[model samples]
Target: MQEVGSAGTIAVARRPEHRGRSLYTQALFRLLTQKPMGVLGLAIVVVLVVAAIGAPWMAPADPNALASGAKLEGPSLSHPFGTDNLGRDVFSRVVFGARISMTIGLVAVITSTVISVAIGVLSGFFGGVVDLLFQRLIDALIAFPGLVLILAMVAIFADTDLPGLPEEGAISTPTVVLMGTIGFLLGVGGSRIIRSAVLSVRASTYVEAAQSLGAGDLRLMRTHILPNVLPPTITLATLGLGTAILLEATLSFLGLGVPPNIATWGGMLNREARSWMTEAPWLALFPGLALSLAVFGFNMLGDALRDVLDPRLRT
Candidate 1:
């Protein structure tokens, strides 16, 4: 009897180990068989992430530093992408701008993920008054015009500043704030999706078995429900980062975002909107192209991830 019980424990442990190995092998095979779009997207995303992370050290010169005579110069051997209105290197600003764009995307997405996951897991697991209240709250938020709501939030928080952030933090103050505000609102979508996923998972036989085995609610949620919900949530969160970045650029272009003195691709386009289109088209072209490519890469990556990770999309 004792030997039989020990064998049962060994089998149970081996089950999880086998599952882990299977998952790893599946992931490897998927990666090896990735489509051209997926490969290209991953490459571009890697480049963008590297640029964003290495911005400070990689910038040719001070992005904010102004040299009076260099203003409005076209791309040359000396000034590759030329200088902006204030004589700051456009290339430098754009490089540094990557930092800003990526930072906001990363930070806001993290914040959104945490808040949304909590709201979603609790709402789905409880499924009573707790669910009802959260559902209504999220519904109301969804009802608002997304961009308009973000702008309103930005306007409200325009005067508010974080006490601990360094002074150099805001290259385009308004744009960062707007992106964060919009990103938070967008988080609600993820939360709602997660809640629904959780609901479905709660009905699964494994969940019922766990409950019958006297596993507590918290344990069931953390160990079982959350894991099931994460695959889809990861896909959503990645795609959402691209959307948030694009929105920030749009807001910046409309003069509702970062300041002129700061250098972002969007800010650069806005500053040179009139003259750069004619005199130095590369000024607008390269930055705009980069932004589009960045968005496209992330989107393709999300699609690939869905195909690879989502059970619904799996063959």
Candidate 2:
């Protein structure tokens, strides 16, 4: 009898671990075999990540260096993407821009996910007054036009100084402002998705059983509700990454994101690219292509993740 009881305890302990491994394995298999777009998206994402990390080594020339003799040159053996009006290498600038875009996408998504998860878990778990108040706040934020709100916020904080930070810190003031604004906007809107997921989990039999067994609210949330809600939360974060990157590009194009010295995809287009489009089309073409590919990859991956992670959509 003692041996049987010990074996039963061991089995129960290993069950969750086995289940987790199985789920991950299934998701991987489906992502690789069932979703062609997912595979393509993953490839594009991997390439961009590698390009961003290896910009210094991959780029042949300095992105900002003036090559007076190479001004307005078209694509050639010497300059694959050609030179801009200012004589800077278009390919090098595009390569370096990948770093900025990826950074903003990753940082904004992380910030928004944290906010969405915290607010959503609390609002859904604690219903009544807490839920009502949180919902009202979310509604207020939703009332504003997202792009307009972000533009206004960026304009307001564009010149704000960050005290005690060095002039050459990895993250600058404008980057912080952009990340915070984008994160806040996406986070509040995304909370509704998370809240709905939590509401469903909250009503489940397991949750009710745990409550009946004297599980505290924190334990119920941390141990049960949070885990169940992670699928949708991850899906939301994945989708939001593309949105954040596009928003940053838009802001930069408008001359309201990052510093002028930084070479962003949108900034590349916004600078002399617009005026020289008829003469030097490569200036705009390459940057625009990179931006489009990045957004498309993220969107495809997010859609595939949603289908894989959401049981309702699974085959």
Candidate 3:
């Protein structure tokens, strides 16, 4: 009897220790061990992140500076990716664009995840009219095309003045709008997913035991429920990053994302550049390639994460 009791106690003690190892560490380890595409994607993303972080020091020349002779120049030792129509080094602009893309992706996914998790948990745990109402509301919103919603928000808020900028065109507006839009959409979707996870775990024998022991709702969620849900949440959020970045870039390409002077991968591939694609094919090709690479990298990483977190998905 004592041996069984000691074993059970030891198991209980080790449970917390087992959970303490960082999920990020585990996920990264899994990613490293995965297929070639996963490693390649991680490598590409790391390079872009490094370039973004070191843009000021790494860029060969000013991303915005213009020179009459440098305009439409082909690839050279001085400007490896060549110069755009405006004579700005395409390499520098591409490097700088990485910062904006990464920022938007990270911010939007994180914000959405937090908001969605909170609502989903609250609704799922309580299990009453609150859940019903919130779920119904979210379902209605989900029915609308996301693009139309973002466009509607843009039209409504376009004329509104931002704090630092004038009533005229301000990049901050779209940045905020895009981040919130993506976050809200993802959060709503995530709520359903998270709620499902919560429900599945809520009925477990351990959960019932905790409840019988007089654990509060908040305690049950914080200590017992949230941890189990985290792996899938993280996987979803990482995947969502690529989508958020792509959407923001789309807005930028549509002339609604960022300011004119500021460089974005999408802005670099704007209509004006497309018009000259025949004359200066490199103009659209390089930025488009970079954007595609950014999306691809995130997607591969997300897939790796999914495979790592959900063993069922792994071969």
TM-score of each candidate structure, all chains considered together:
0.86, 0.92, 0.90
Residue-level lDDT for 126 in candidate 3: 82
Cα-based lDDT for every prediction: 0.74, 0.85, 0.79
TM-score rank order = 2, 3, 1
Tens digit of per-residue lDDT, candidate 1, span 1-315: 012264463111111223445664685478458656767777888988999889888778898888998877888777777876668777777787787777777767776788788889999999999999999999998898888987787778667665654333463445556656866776887898889888988887677766766779998887778877777778778888888778878877776656555666677677674565786677787678778988998898878777877657776
lDDT of 1: 0.74
RMSD of each: 3.6, 3.4, 3.3
**Candidate 2 per-residue lDDT over residues 209-253, each given as its tens digit:** 667657799988877888778778878988898899899889889
Clashing pairs in 2: none
Worst 10 residues of 3 by lDDT: 9-18
**Against the correct fold, how does model 1 do in TM-score?**
0.86
> Model 3 scores what on Cα lDDT?
0.79
lDDT of 3 by residue, 39-120 (tens): 8878878988998889888889888898888788888899888888878898898888888888888888999899888988
Question: What is the descending lDDT order?
Answer: 2, 3, 1
- C-alpha positional error of residue 200 in candidate 1 after TM-score superposition, expressed in Å: 2.1
Where does model 1 exceed 4 Å of error? 1-25, 166-168, 171-179, 257-259
